[model samples]
Each structure stands twice: as C-alpha cells, then as structure tokens.
Target: MKKTLRNTILGLTVTALFISGTLCGCGKKAPPIPASRLDFLEIEVAEQEKYIQEAEAKYLEERAKLEAANDSKGVRLLDTMNRERLRNEKQILKKQQKELEKLRQSEANKK
Candidate 1:
C-alpha cells in the first residue's frame, strides 16, 4: 500500500512537469528561415499589394455603376462586402509583413 501511494505521487509529479514544459514551449526558438524563403515572402507581399490595388479599383468601379443606377441597397451591400474583404486581406498582409520582418531581423542577427 505504501509503495502504491509513492508511485502514484511520483506519476502525478512527472505528469505535471510534462504538462508545464509543453505549455511553456520548453524555451525553444523557431528555426531560422532561409534567404530563398525570404525572397518568396517578398514576392508574396508584392503580389498581395497588387491584388489589393486591383480589388480597390474594382470596388470603385462597381460602386460607381450602382450609384449611376440609383441602387442604394446594392451600393450598401457592396460597400459592406468590400470593407470586410479589404479588412481580411489587409490583416493577412500585415501578418505576412510582420513575419517577413521577423525573419529578416533574425537573418541580420546571424550575419
């Protein structure tokens, strides 16, 4: 009975340590991104910028058409959808930019 209790306590302690280490990330850092990956990220950012510009132009054109037709509802709906889409796209772009910056910084540190 005493041995069984000691074993149970040891097991609980080990389990707690494992859980804590996993939750705390084990003090590990991410692997560095290569220069090729950075170049790809730059290209991706450029493409995203171009896509955003095109989307804005298209939204304006559509808005103009709806206004000319005097369709207030269509205009409102289009505006809402465009706003949401732009918001999501911009968020993605911002996240990518941050990642790129982080990788670049890490690369610079290595140099």
Candidate 2:
C-alpha cells in the first residue's frame, strides 16, 4: 500500500510539472499572423491599373484616328464623337488611377 501511494504521488507530480512546462511556454510568444497579411489590397489595385491602361490605349487610338481623318460633315461628326469618347475614356482612366492609389494607401495603412 505504501509503494502504491508513493507511485501515485510521483505520477501526479510529474504530470503537474509537464502541464506547467507546456503552459509556461505559451505566454511568452507572440501571435502567429503578422500585421501585413491581415489586410491585402493588391488585387483591386492591379485590376484598376489594368483598366487605366486599356482606357489610355483606347483614348490615344481614337485621338490619332480623329487627327488623321479628312474634314467633312461625317468626318466632323465622327471626330466630335471620338473626342467625346476620348474624354470619357480619360475620365475613366483617371478614376481607375485614383482607385488604385486609394487601394495602395489602404494597404499601406494596414501595415
């Protein structure tokens, strides 16, 4: 009976020491996730960049076509329309560029 009681006390002491050792290690460390990974905004910025590029390309092409055409009523009408279209495309490009900047700023703020 005395041997059994001594064995039980030893077992309990070892178990308590193991549990204390495990819990002691947990309090001193930081969390797993870093600050940068919590908020990601690159994908939206990339999409906005793509949209701005395409809009700029289209605006430049229409401006060139407007410049090359001979002056006539139809040509004048087309030129007017192309000019309007180019203006709209530029506005869209500007808007997309702004969105990209905003996304980048938001991402930077997260870090």
Q: What is the TM-score of each candidate against the true structure?
A: 0.67, 0.39
Clashing pairs in 2: none
Roughly what TM-score does model 1 have, to 2 decimal places? Answer: 0.67
lDDT of 1: 0.88
Least accurate 10 contiguous residues by lDDT in model 2: 30-39
Off by over 4 Å in 1: 1-35
Candidate that would win on lDDT: 1
Candidate lDDT (C-alpha), each: 0.88, 0.62
Candidate 1 structure quality by residue, lDDT tens digits, 21-91? 64345655433443597887987898899999999999999999999999999999999999999999999
- Candidate 1 lDDT at 28 equals 54
Instruction: Report the lDDT tens digits of candidate 2 across residue range 1-111.
Output: 999999999999867765656434655442233244222334444655676578667756756675677435655676677668767766765766676677677778979
